[model samples]
Target: MIAEHAVPTSVELLRLDADSPRTAEVRRKVVGLRLAPGQQRFSGEAAHTLPRADTDPNRVPFAVLYRQTPVGFGIIDQRGILDEITAAPAEAVLLRAFYLDPEWQGRGIGRTACLALDPLVRSVRPEANEVVLTVNEANPAAVRAYRSGGFTATGERYLGGDAGPQLVMRRPVPYEGGAGDG
Candidate 1:
């Protein structure tokens, strides 16, 4: 189910189904710019390795991370999106890849995307005591974003083949019936 959340001055976020054409463009942004600067593991190989589940029910693309709407997009996973992270450590769902369009950055949209996550994550797993994710070590900006939004690093990383290293961070669930658990 695609979902949207509003936060006054903050950017409005939309979680889209994988089939959304917006997914392709968003993935492209991550591949072209978002992953450069030693912050991501998205080499040409990983980019091409995008899941066959674009139209599948199990996977959904995260909102275009923009001011009014996503100038680009990001991808988040539920339970089985990836083999390593979910299979090894074993978590229920994950806030996965984040991609931002250059034109839409530098205005707190990234932060908005980060903040919006808490509610969406909690809504699906109201009983979930924790929410977890894997991020590349090179992405310090993202690390900072997660930290500011109440996540603590577990001091662990997942290496996907030779794609590079990803750090795992988590936050404890705060509200049983958060701002939007409907």
Candidate 2:
């Protein structure tokens, strides 16, 4: 059972290690991650997604931590769906398998985690200039969260998703250094 907490906590994204003890704990927590019935159609459980990410060289898995506890999961795809489903620049990275545990939802953790993705993506894929994701048309809450986190719809709909049509959204990866800072 998930512990019930009333206050929103700090959110951070940490790269996961398939063999680490901390990751093992996270894996256990993932088994209990619950999504609403409607959400089940749009996002995948981390328990299933993480194993695939572990074997894919181009995919980087991240554990979303809130108050130092694992509360969500996400993956950064280097080039998996670029031309296959969506058209994006070569420097763009795909945000996949992103979802928070239902118990942790609505506390602004998702938006905070989304805002924290830029640095994490840059750390792993320095050449990435933008982050792109496809949200099912039925998932308005997710679209709103992504928008709040700085993504904008590209007016393109992807029909390849199994659930239904999806909107392609993207946001530029913010650069840390200013002009002449190199």
Candidate 3:
């Protein structure tokens, strides 16, 4: 089943089903989506390496959909957090390889998806409190998008990225309490 959550900008993040025809379509389109010279490091192809249920049972890949149409892709995984650029807390999730199709860029899909990730990730990683990602400093556009979507720089820099130095960013998950508040 493709799990989805309503988000702003009429975009929803759907859990990618590797065996589904939809996944193939997204993959085909991803091959043609070009990223800016500095943003190529965040290719959707890298997202494909994240473990799925059939592979590791702990990682998840998501397809960004605009009105039920696939427009982007990303992955959220807890693995390698301890060894990745930043030492995220045990309850923190690593948002990796987030990329929007070139055709869908500049339409706010990226920011909307970033904001909507809280609920989408909670569906599987309910304990996750903060989502972390490292963006190449060279990719100012991405850094701007993420910052606009509520992520803040963590003052941590990693020079291991192929594109150059990367800055660590973190966004705390919004609290969702059950029942009425008032």
Which candidate leads the pack in lDDT?
Answer: 2
lDDT of 1 by residue, 1-182 (tens): 12323332645455543456765555555444434344345422224324443655544555545434445345445564335543332334566556555445455556566666655655444444456677667767777767865677877778763556878787665555554322
Output the worst ten-in-a-row residue range by lDDT, candidate 2: 1-10
TM-score of candidate 1 relative to the true fold: 0.62
Query: What's the true lDDT of residue 91 in model 2?
Result: 74
- RMSD of every prediction: 6.8, 3.8, 5.9
Provide backbone clash counts, one per model.
2, 0, 0
Decide which is better by lDDT, 1 or 3.
3
lDDT of each: 0.54, 0.80, 0.71
User: TM-scores, in order shown?
Assistant: 0.62, 0.87, 0.78
TM-score of model 3 (CA atoms): 0.78
**Residue runs of model 3 more than 4 Å from their true location after superposition:** 1-8, 18-34, 42-56, 82-88, 178-182
lDDT of 1 at 38: 47
Candidate number that wins on lDDT, 1 or 2: 2
The candidate that wins on TM-score is 2
Model 1 alpha-carbon drift over 4 Å, by segment? 1-8, 18-40, 43-53, 65-67, 81-91, 122-129, 178-182
